[model samples]
Target: MTSTLVVIGHGMVGHRLADRLRELDTAHRWRVCVLGEEPEPAYDRVRLSAYLRNRSRAALSLVRPDFLADPRITVRSASPAVSVDRRARTVHTAGGEPITYDALVLATGSRPFVPPVPGRHLGNCFVQRTVEDIDALSAAARPGRPAVVIGGGLLGLEAAQGLQLLGMRPHLVESAPHLMPAQLDGEAARVLQDGAARLGLHLHCGTTVVSVDGGAGGLVRSVTLGDGSVVEADLVVFAAGIRPRDDLPVTPALPLAERGGYLTDAFCRTADDRIWAVGECAAVLGRCHGLVAPGYRMADSVACGLTGHHADPLDEMDDSTELKLLGVHVATFGSTSGDAGTAVEVTFQEGASRYAKVFLHRASGALLGGILAGETGSRADLAPWVGRRPTADLESVLFPAPPFRPLSP
Candidate 1:
């Protein structure tokens, strides 16, 4: 009895699952069908901002050229699964096609969150998410105009920098006291703020957007801040945040996260054993990992389960991330706490562009975690030692090694 699997998304995580299944299902035990609402196949959304500069759709593609050639796999673009008839084990698409599957995987990914402010639907307001979004923004981007990017997160910063690259003045707004509130400590955020300023992005932190008002022709002309201050702008881009795309039909009405996303077990399995969720849509242990690395790990776990391997349930995934935002390098990993004085903390802040800090067990000197804001010179090496036993040679890990005047060895 050949089992058919209907994957209801084709984003990075969905595609990864399909690739793994194709690789492992040597006996062809399962035939696969992937549904993507987008007109094009899965592409690298991580680099979506680069679309403005590159303008080549082919370059952002994550789909293999031969993906469609596989005899056991089929892909349907521009088709979204509208509803799931669980009793019948079928998925109904917007195109009026019913796809039957012995098992279903929901990887609908996420959607950009647009805050409900007056005139949000104004002409020049956009959300930075899909390739089409960047394309549309790029079309409206003109030299010497100003673009207001709402949010100071990674995506928001990316949009700001992309607009700056296109010769447009970019202003960044954030409700948080600093950028990347979830990832960076106060000092680290200060460092990142300095970097953004260097890249020509005007900062508006710790304020809210009151409203966006339109001028003649109903295009975005100015924006009102929380403090009643207004700024002239040609366009507004919302990179606020993302919410899981969990509205799609799921048979049995799978449990959803309080914040919005499909709730699942560590194995990525929903309430029904035959159904699974992964990627941004899967909320494991009451939290959704918006990053791609954890999504990949979940994809691998689901693949192992479907391939008949008793893979251990995903637990304690390393959420450490390192990336360059607007040409600023920022990285953080493990526990960030050292204020309790339980651990020894060493910090080095060089001017406004560089800050590095590492925490170690006070007694044994074991590496705990660290923060690298501006210029991180090979500090990534310390990530692997996060859980390792303490080493006596903490001098090497310090920003500046202690003076070595010993016998010229």
Candidate 2:
């Protein structure tokens, strides 16, 4: 009998996994179905902000134009998986179609996590996750319109900048005392805030949005703060955070973490050996990595394992990350949380334009984890070295000064 594989969610990792499976097994003996809830094919959700700021639709496409034409694959758009009956090996769709499968892959991914604040459901408020989200916000954003982004993290900053691109004045409202609180320290966050301001984005740290005022036709007009001050806003984009989408109504208890992610082993397999979960939905090592790289790696590992390849389990310590955000070069790897060590921590800063930090284990000279900002040259050179070498070599490499450059082009 031909094996059937059903992949839920047509996001980045899901679509890539489907493509990889078809490439590895070209015999067309096995049937594959990719179900997507969205109306269009898989697109790059990572760059959705760019779409809001006038980027062409072609730039956001993740799959090739001819992807749907593949014979071995069935692309089902506007179809959402409503339930998964693991016992029957069938998944029920929103349209009441029960698709039976030998193997099931849940790549449900995640959705924007909006807090339970008052007036959150008001019009003129958006979450920048989908192409439709960008289209709606772009149409509403006009020149001199006051825009506010709640949550001063990566997406929040990007949304603020995107609004600025549309000639709207953007203000960043963060509840934390510092910006990028998850990745940067107080001093480092200050540098990021300075850089943001240079781009005409206002930073409002340590402020909470108590409620959104939508007196004008249920469309957001302004945000009321905890301090009882009202900041006028024509539109608001909530990039506060995201939660994994795992709403399958199954009777048998599926292992799930406290954070609502599927508890999976290193190979992205669930407690049930035949079933697997990958991407943002899987919580490996008791943590859910929201980044795309880890999700891609998980997808590859599972695909390799299914095809009889010598696939290894995921490493518990995946401390390697490097990327540039909005022209700011930032990289962080290993252990930002200080460990019990005998070693040294060094930091170098060049005003608000450049910063570099390193943490080392004192006794063994192991490179724990570090952060780099503003120095594109150093990040490009050091990120790989940090991943490959132990602490001793990192110590011998000697520290270098950070390169200073203005945030603006």
Candidate 3:
């Protein structure tokens, strides 16, 4: 009997998993069914903001237009998995088709988080997650419409930049005290905020939206803050955050975290062994990794385990991360803890656009985490050492002079 593998989200992680499975067991006659809720093949969601700004749809295509030529993989666009009958080992689609599978993977990724505020239902309120959303927002937007993006994280900042390109004066509202609170420290957040302001983004920190008044004709007229202050705007985009969509297939009894995510063991398997979840939906151990790299690692581990190989469940995704955000280079990693007194940090600032910070555990001298701003060259090469949990030469590895210059140079 041929084995059937049904992958629910046809996104980047899903596509990669399907391709990897075919590579591992080609002779076994495995049938791969990829279902995407979107009406198109998987596209690079990471570049959605760039698509909005550059007005280029071709840049985000993950699979070729004629990807269906692959004999082993069959795709269903605009179809979603409605429910899964664990006992029958079959999935029911929204269109009332039953897909029986020996193995089921829920790559049903996360969705853009929109907060509950008055007038949020207004017509001009938008989000930039899918191509359709970008098209709608692009059609409704004009230069100098006074747009406000709620959230100061990576996505929010990126959307703000896109709004500026559309000729709108954008302001960012962050509930946290600093920007990119999950990725950057207070000092680094300040640097990022400065960079954003230079790109014509206004910042409103430590503020929450109380209500949005669409008193104007079907458009967001102004947003009232918790402090009774209001800012007038013609449009509002909620880039607040992402939430995993687990409300499908009749809401399984799978354990969910307090912060809203499906709980899974180290191997990315839920309580039901036949159904394995990956990507943004599964919370490995006790934490849900929001980034793509850790998600991909989880996909690989599950894939390997099913093929009867020894692959450890994902653990400790090297707290360090470095990236170029809207032209400004930023990095952070490890335990950047100072109040616990378990780590020591040192910062070096040469001039206006150069800064580096290194954090090390006090007793073990192990590099916990660090950051490089304004310079991000060769930062990825250090990821392996950080992922392996070895005691690094903090001073030498981060601040190598001349011939052994560190990544930031």
Candidate 4:
């Protein structure tokens, strides 16, 4: 007896879920149907900025070349899931096609949050989310022209770098006091600011975009800041943030998070057992994980549940991350900052480029959270030790033994 499964959105996390179910369901107990909004199949979204340099579609693809040919799976590109009728166990597509399913998974992912500025919808303004968005931006940007990227976070900085590669002078604007507020603390962000400057991006932190000014041709010409400063821009790219794509199938009965997203339990199951959500569209424990790491974990858990295994409730997730942004290395493990009574901080800096900070419980000597900027040579060794107890000596815990440890009691 084969059960039909309908997966909405074919992004990386959605594809991972589909692949996992197929691999584990050896008895052919499940048949899968995937509906993707984008014309292209799943690709490496983390490497999206890199597409500006290479301009090759195949380079960013996440699908195995021959995997989609499986008879048990059916994929439809450019077909988005418009609605899900839980009562009838059917999904409606944008093309007016109805897909029946025994189980449904929502992987609608998210869309870039473009601020409602006056001229945002004008020409030469783009949001960095899909391949088409980047392509349109590339075509609109000209060499040596001034470009404004409205965000100093990871994606915004990446977009600025991509604009630079296209021979455009880039300016980065951030509403927060510093860049990467979610990942790096104030000090770490200062060092990262210096690194971004070295990469040829002019930065403006602690400012808000009041409005975008357009030229007579209905194209963006400049942006006005809160302090009455106007920056001339030939092209503007918005990488401010993301909002979950939750408005579909008009299901008001489904549980939703505070902001937006399908509220799911530990196993990524919604109030309706037959309906499950994963990826950016899933809000678990009242928190929506925007990053891919947690999404992958959720997909793994869902697969385990569907395959007749008792999926253990997730106790914790390794949200620790280490990645290079705009020629700077940034890593955050466990916690980025500590404010508890037992919090104790230790910091280590080398030369002018590398910085590391660690927080631990003063009484138990257990690791709390940390931030690392510049050269992160020890991140590989440090991140794994998070949440564990260290020796009586705190200095050794802050800095690990030379790359490969000597290992002593």
Which ranges of candidate 3 are over 4 A from the true structure?
64-67, 250-252, 337-341, 376-378, 381-409
Better of 3 and 4 by TM-score: 4
Q: What local lDDT score does residue 74 receive in model 1, on the 0 to 100 scale?
A: 91
lDDT of 1 by residue, 21-113 (tens): 888887789899999989998898998767777799999998886778998889999998899988888999998989988989999999999
In angstroms, the error of model 1 at 408 is: 31
Better of 1 and 4 by lDDT: 4
lDDT of 4 by residue, 1-409 (tens): 9999999999999999999888889888999999999998899888888898899999999888666988889999999988888888899998998999999999999989998878888889999888888889888889999999998888898898889889999998999999988788887888888888887889989998999999978988999998789999998999999999887864547879998899888788989989889999888866688899999988888988898866777556667778887777888888755865877877776544667778887787778878887765546666666677754554454444323221222
Our model 3 lands, by Cα RMSD against the true structure, at 3.6
Q: What does the lDDT come to for candidate 3? A: 0.76
lDDT of 3 by residue, 185-282 (tens): 67667667767767767889998999878865677888888777899888899999999877675444667767766778888887888777888887
How do these models rank on TM-score, best leading? 4, 1, 2, 3
Candidate 2 per-residue lDDT, tens place, 113-224, comes to 8988998999999998888888888889889878889998877877887888889999889999987788877766766776777777877889899998896788999998
Pairs of colliding residues, candidate 3: 83-249, 143-167, 144-167, 320-333
- C-alpha lDDT (0 to 100) for residue 397 of candidate 3: 48
- The Cα local distance difference test for each model comes to 0.83, 0.78, 0.76, 0.84
Every candidate's CA RMSD: 3.6, 3.8, 3.6, 3.4
Sort all candidates by lDDT, best to worst: 4, 1, 2, 3
Task: Please identify model 2 stretches exceeding 4 Å from their true place.
Answer: 26-29, 317-321, 340-343, 376-378, 387-409
- For all predicted structures, in order, the TM-scores are 0.93, 0.91, 0.90, 0.94
Q: Which candidate leads in lDDT?
A: 4
